[model samples]
Target: MTARVDSAPADSQAEAFKRLYPDQYYRRFLSQNTRPDGRSLTQTRPASVVLGVITSADSSALIKIGNTTVIAGVKLEVLMPKDPPDQGCLQVNVELTTLCSPEMRDNRPTEVPSFLTQQVDAAVRGSSAWQPQALCIQAGRAAWAVYLDLYVLCADGVLLDACVLAAMAALNALRLAPVDVTDAGNVVAAGNDAMTDGTSHPQQPYALSKQGTPLTLTCAVIDDRLIADPSSEEESLAATVVSTTVDGQGHVMGLQHAGGGVELSTAHLQQCITAAQDRHTDLFRVLSSAQPPDH
Candidate 1:
């Protein structure tokens, strides 16, 4: 059987560009309360998420918010901690593949990874998503350091939101085996234990902390449209405000008035956060729909 292919018509690009970037004079004159996409000021783009799509990964997730798509994979490795020997660490990296966008090239320098890393680090640190104590095998000794890799195969708008959602979903899908430490303080595996069988092993206490919510939502500003999850063209043509609020819980982390030239009012900023909270339902549904990863 031949694989089915889906694609936009030839005129779609032109149409999209036209829709995003209207004539200069008209754009300047159109100071309507609504957005160009006909969405309410508090509406967010539609989002879909899938988990455990990758058969070989310990945990993985695919997120689609409007035209943007991102995949996040988690890999766990046991290594000795430097300063905090009793605690393991988590390293998160985000890569914007060349195929995703023209701006991301093969050999060129890209700050995307660093920026995303910082954001993820902040979120992870601020929230008690992963217990550092659980990762430790021995006091001032060996532990597990989880490596989270995020690849942006496509980015239309709101890359930060996609990244955070993907990361959280991956964390949820994770099921690692328990690690055993030898008398020499080296990490090893136990025999015949389901939680530590040398493959996709997860230890006991398979739970997240209750201090903070699961994920973050990002809101951006495109022209006069304060949109959640902006498309690439929309992102390019307007000042942006990226804000994220955890589910049920209030806003623990947020960044706004980014990329210069746009000053969002306190009222407008609150509107954006409120919009994100409404969208959080969609995010929750997507996460709830995913099945546990098969290791």
Candidate 2:
């Protein structure tokens, strides 16, 4: 026979209990229709975007989604691809260091979400955030390759969402000096635009043709409930995670299972898409308001 206590758990006792029984502690909160972070099942944390944070990079932006922070920097290089000689290329690399999370502190090393880069890459390319034709300096001769590097400075969770926001904001904030091919077969920027290394001066900026910037939402299902923008703690307890990437126009750019092999129902998938679309409205507003050093 079990006896029930009338009094609720003390805050300090609850905290200690959470430390000892993490899974049960978290599930206790979830059973009450909320998360440990105090967010509703469908709620997401606040987000912010800051542009032109890195002076050395061609373009850069820092984005924060709750505690998760990601900084994206881009450098434009000239290249001629074998298949698509005239089109420009976009290379994305995402790195999560030890500073971002305690799990990465040991020498053993921790693997980040393997699909985060793929999700952001698919969204960026599919949406034409950078136009292939615009990247070409001369037809089939020379083209621009955008190297986008994203660093996760904080690891609260919803990593893909933060990374995608950083990448999109950085791409749109790009300001490059006009460049042309010289008689010596060298590409040079217009007057006073290039440094000794032939890279565009950060002061002289030209806007790149960007469209359909992406906003990604990651939802975790636990106890048959969908939770949006789960924190790292919540992610650990999830049965599965589904990421939905959408544009400002509510068009779905990409969708995938980011974690766990557990299958989700059609309704759950639709719910994620809807959440992403709603997130786009707020995030796009923030992106639009970003102020770069130059136009």
Best by lDDT: 2
**Candidate 1 clash pair list:** 156-232, 176-201, 176-202, 177-200, 177-201, 177-202, 178-195
Error of 2 at 295 (Å): 9.4
Per-model TM against the reference: 0.80, 0.87
Given candidate 1, what's the lDDT at residue 102?
76
lDDT of 1: 0.70
Worst 10-residue stretch by lDDT in candidate 1? 196-205
Q: How would you encode candidate 2's per-residue C-alpha lDDT over 1-295 as one tens digit per residue?
A: 8998776669978988988999899888988998888889998898988888888899899999999999999998987655676677889888886689888777564456446677778778888555776676665666778899999999988898898899889889876556766656577765553444354434444677766777888898888889999999888888998888898788888887856678799999898999999988988888999888763
Candidate 2 overall Cα lDDT vs. reference? Answer: 0.82
